[model samples]
Target: MYKYNNFYKKNFIFKIIENDIRNKKYNIICTRFPPEPNGYLHIGHIKSICLNFSIAKFYKGIFFLRIDDTNPSTENIKYIKSIKKDLIWLGFKWDKNIKYSSNYFDLIYKYAIELIKKNLAYVDELNIKDIKNYRGTLLIPGKNSPYRNRSIEENLELFKKMRLGRFPEGKVSLRAKIDMQSKVIVMRDPVLYRIKFQEHHQTGKKWCIYPTYDFSHCIADAIEGITHSLCTLEFQDNRILYDWILNNISIKHHPKQYEFSKLKIEYGITSKRNINILIKNKIVSGWDDPRLLTISGLRRKGYTASSLKDFCYRIGITKQNNIIEISSLESCIRLELNKIAPRAMAVLRPLKIIIDNFPSNKKIKLLIPNHPNNKNMGYKNIYFTKEIYIDILDFSEIEKKNYKRLILGGKVRLRYSFIIKAKKIIKNKNGNITCIHCIYYKDTLGIKIDKKKRIIKGIIHWISCSYSKPALFYLYNNLFIKKNINNIDNILSFLNKKSLLIYNGFIEKNLLQLNNNNQHFQFEREGYFFFDKKYSNKNKIIFNRIISLKKKNN
Candidate 1:
């Protein structure tokens, strides 16, 4: 497991890229992140990003960003562009020489020709359905195709015609001539190339025939001179096919594939298939919706690149399948933010509290540290006044034991300001309490008993109504209501009804003067939040709670 300490971050990074001037230990360790351009990258993809790029960085070699856009029907140029952007955003820079699976079509076709020449592969005219029947099933031996016995010359001519678009899609396929009952089913004459008439985004109409990933990936790695082809565990079985393809064709470099377990975060689905289903059904707002697990989604939700890297590092890597608690990830972000995020004051679901004894328009600014324990972040002032807005949940009309907040004639600290005691309850015509009017005891009561004396049972945050700014607060909880967001239960039904709540809230005046470029802040006694980068400004800012403070690792 890669440790979370700076040392581990440094070593795991370097291990992938060890320098050797003597050339005795190892050669330039070239690695590639070959993502199929069908969907956006998710948290799981980040683990791959870290492993591949960090290895390249560690070995002083190259990390190539190769778009494995072989499937023309589903792959898109938009996804390719977005994946490149995602890598850059994740703080990874690939080697200058970029590659795409489509770029090697010429070489792949040449290799297919070589396979045909060696009598190691042949063109099979069997339609996919009949081919599957001939390929047999789990407990039976497959029968050889009728076209399997075609003369090498006839097969070559037809293969060239297949490349020249003489055949319809799937009417003919180029398959490897491996064992029919080798036990390992994939080795049983697997299809290496298929014909797709669809316009490929890249290498458009150059050839109708394209090599499958199993065939193309190994050849590409060898062509690029990759040393260690690290991939997820799902490819372990595919290693046989990859080896067969590479071994049959002599290449400059023979890369070894090593598989590790994929990352899984519970309460989140990282599957592009599932994401596509959700999107097609209009279940999510968009790819960048904060509720999603896509890179853009996480970024939109205010996840910092460094924090995400730390989370990936903390989770470690192994070959065993794991369904990590989403809370573990949240913990990493919170731990990092706690060390760097600035502190502020915000009250959501504001309950108006008017101190009648104090001057109606008075504003007293109290010095508050930007980071409670770190003065180097500097200090800002929070205004306290006669009229203030506290959280509605922080107060109860009827008191319970240890319910330290506002109630009938109860007293509590006003956080950095004079303590006030409720003197009267103001109500509406329907007997619902409209507001609670109180009197500030500036001398003998509150968080500060005097200039030197203090009484603090529970400190609650409030924003001055007289001087503070009103912000639109978006409070978000876990998107799913299910206990296991990964497996079981209907995720669609578990989608929290109250995931995103819009409220007109109050913030300290200093928040109004806040620099919009910085998206991080912790509202004292409230939660962690960031001013929305896309929709916040000085006059009226929109703040989104990244996560609340009540959330702790259990």
Candidate 2:
């Protein structure tokens, strides 16, 4: 095993593992990320994936990608494939071939038989509702089932019948013969196996009985020689049963279970059930709709793996659970994109500007740096023509206080070009401003003019009307308006109806020369955007806004 390093020493779980290593507990440490193939992996799973995979890599140990496909009624092959693809996209390599709980069904069933022979487990005929009543509440001790005291031979026979498709779904279940009156509710003779008539995606219809997650999880861990079984705080109580099953079983290399707080973000829905509801109602486009917090959705929205990993590391590991601000996660992507995304200018809501002083036939090629701070990124050629488009928000007929953008008879500097003074405005019959006529100072190009004398204190990005290409823009925002959705009964009521806003815009024509590599670009004074390859074609180009530019600090 590799020695514990300073980087991982801060994590409490790593500290525990380091102590085990120092005490010569085992030769090699092992970990696994076992996800149920019921839904797509979300932002919440990213933390666990990073923690489990990072710990194993840091220790030079083994890590496995196991599919916890115990309940086949909800599981599907698509979800399993999505899980593997997400892991690979996030840059994690699992050891050997992928493992499945279904692969060890025969062994787990044999272990169940061993427990029955040892008189530690018994088959229960109690219905689901009656079993719940017998389980009792946290304040009350549970009562034993009527069939709890069945003879070992009878219990074994009934269990074998259950395995042989003799029992219908929910007609019979195998429960561990643990304390029925225990204060911990899960230890009140928890069900180990239940009859599932549904065909499993992995095992098909070979067997009619299925093992519960609690029973299969620990045994699978021990069988694979997993040293640390890490899960979220919700599974902390399940640890009792995890230990009980492992301790009574005739298995070696029992792994210890540890729990940490799950990652939760404000206004973000990570629950697969709720997301499915949204999909069913057509509230979102699909699983990768970019509005959802699913890993695929984030990827479609241009969130980089490095940024996500940085977010996970910054959140760190802890026992206390809390809802993190969405801005915290947004900061990670913003910071990263600022460094790498090339600069471009786009006018979402365009207002035409005609420069009267500039030559109508002459077009100046202005070389602008792709990155403001990085000189090594070089520059791109942007055309400066007599007619151009500026964002409608950048101009006003009646300027408000502190508004520095263009105004009638007022001057503002065109970014990287010339200082232009708005002389007149053209309006339609409806009184909506359609265009602005301006005059440009030819000598102001690349020069720091006297701001006090000219009263020109604003700079706005513009694209040449003759040289730019028409494009579509998709602006995305939070799906929910409410910050704390825990108490809300109907999540749809709080849905942000205007979460996705579409706009018709123009981009630099030079961008068409670049390869279709799904590149991310920072629209000057706009935001970070990803070229939508799926929607874009030779006739129409589209860009999806990942996030808006952050407000600068004064």
Q: Name the candidate that leads on TM-score.
A: 2
Model 2 Cα lDDT, one tens digit per residue, 17-134 = 9999999997899999999999999998988988888899998999999999999899999999899999999998999999999999999999999999999999999999999999
Which segments of candidate 2 are over 4 A away from where they belong? 1-7, 515-518
> What RMSD does each model have against the real structure?
3.5, 2.3
Give the Å shift of residue 118 in candidate 2. Answer: 2.2
lDDT per residue, candidate 1, 348-376, as tens digits?
78888988888866666678778878988
How high is each candidate's TM-score? 0.90, 0.96
When summed lDDT is taken over every stretch of 10 residues in candidate 2, the lowest stretch is 1-10
lDDT (CA) per prediction? 0.79, 0.90
* lDDT for residue 180 in candidate 1, whole number 0-100: 87
Candidate 1 overall Cα lDDT vs. reference? 0.79
Model 1, TM vs. native: 0.90
